[model samples]
Target: MVTGPAPTAARRSVEEVRERVAAVPDPELPVIGLGDLGVVRSVATGADGVIEVEITPTYLGCPGMAAITSAVRDVLTACGHPDGRVRQVLSPPWTTDRITPEGRRTLLAHGIAPPVSPAPDGPVAVEVGGVPCPHCGSRATRPHSPFGPSRCQSMLWCTACREPFPHLTAL
Candidate 1:
């Protein structure tokens, strides 16, 4: 039998953490996975496999923190890791850009248009120039109110499609 050197404690490779966190499903959207939502920001390992992770939520007020944390822990535990630390950061805020292209496609396929291209360069309206409805691909959508489904999204209805859709509000 051949044996390899024992792995020493150090910040695990970003790739390792990604593979772990990527599988961690979002409590709200179990099908969409956390990695798809672009929530898994930074993952680092310390002595004793003390993993630290930073995540950004789809919405600042999105009420999935506790469940999300538990989900992350579950993935870690499954990976033979016992101690994992997860943290959520609001700085820089969560934006569509963080979301992977695959995630966006997934969201759209699910009938929710991921915010319109991200807020133009700067100092722009959250939903100006109109947001396209991921449902029917119509730009003729209007905000029903300041808020719609969640803080991250506003209510928008498509006149052409005659369907209500969620528009991700750019922060």
Candidate 2:
């Protein structure tokens, strides 16, 4: 656990910093915050305001990587760690399991289904649940494209809604 400047002086605790970072929505998927999207891996701070965060991209070439970095920096800066550095940790890679329980709720609320539990940490085949139609809330959805809006998502059309939605592909 890294400690930052006193909460009275800095107006934010490490947990608060994390909460702020988690609250910043992903620029690409406005419906999901970075935390909800499982982009923020960790947050820590030193005694003298030396803050650092670890994050990994959902996909190798995901366009939102830069945006997530910027959001992390912006939130820390606003919270009094203007010089903080955000590090990208890609070794183990990111998995849907990192998605917080609240994040899963957010995904479901946004009409995007949550991924299966205990997902693998790297690119590996995992079973994905059928996406419910955002319009009609039906499970009769089929993949339109293995690769959809992004590498992590599959383009699917709901037989009930007859509309395309992004479903998190199997791990």
Clash tally, candidates in order: 0, 1
For 69-164, candidate 1 gives per-residue lDDT tens digits of 877776666555547777898887877777778877887887777754635477766554467788778788877767765556677888888898
Candidate 1 CA-lDDT value: 0.73
Could you tell me the lDDT of residue 22 within candidate 2?
A: 82
Model 1 steric clash pairs: none
Name the lDDT value of residue 80 in candidate 1. 53
Question: TM-score for all predictions?
Answer: 0.75, 0.77
- Cα displacement (angstroms), candidate 1, residue 41, comes to 1.0
Residue 116, model 1: lDDT of: 49
Candidates in order have lDDT scores of: 0.73, 0.77
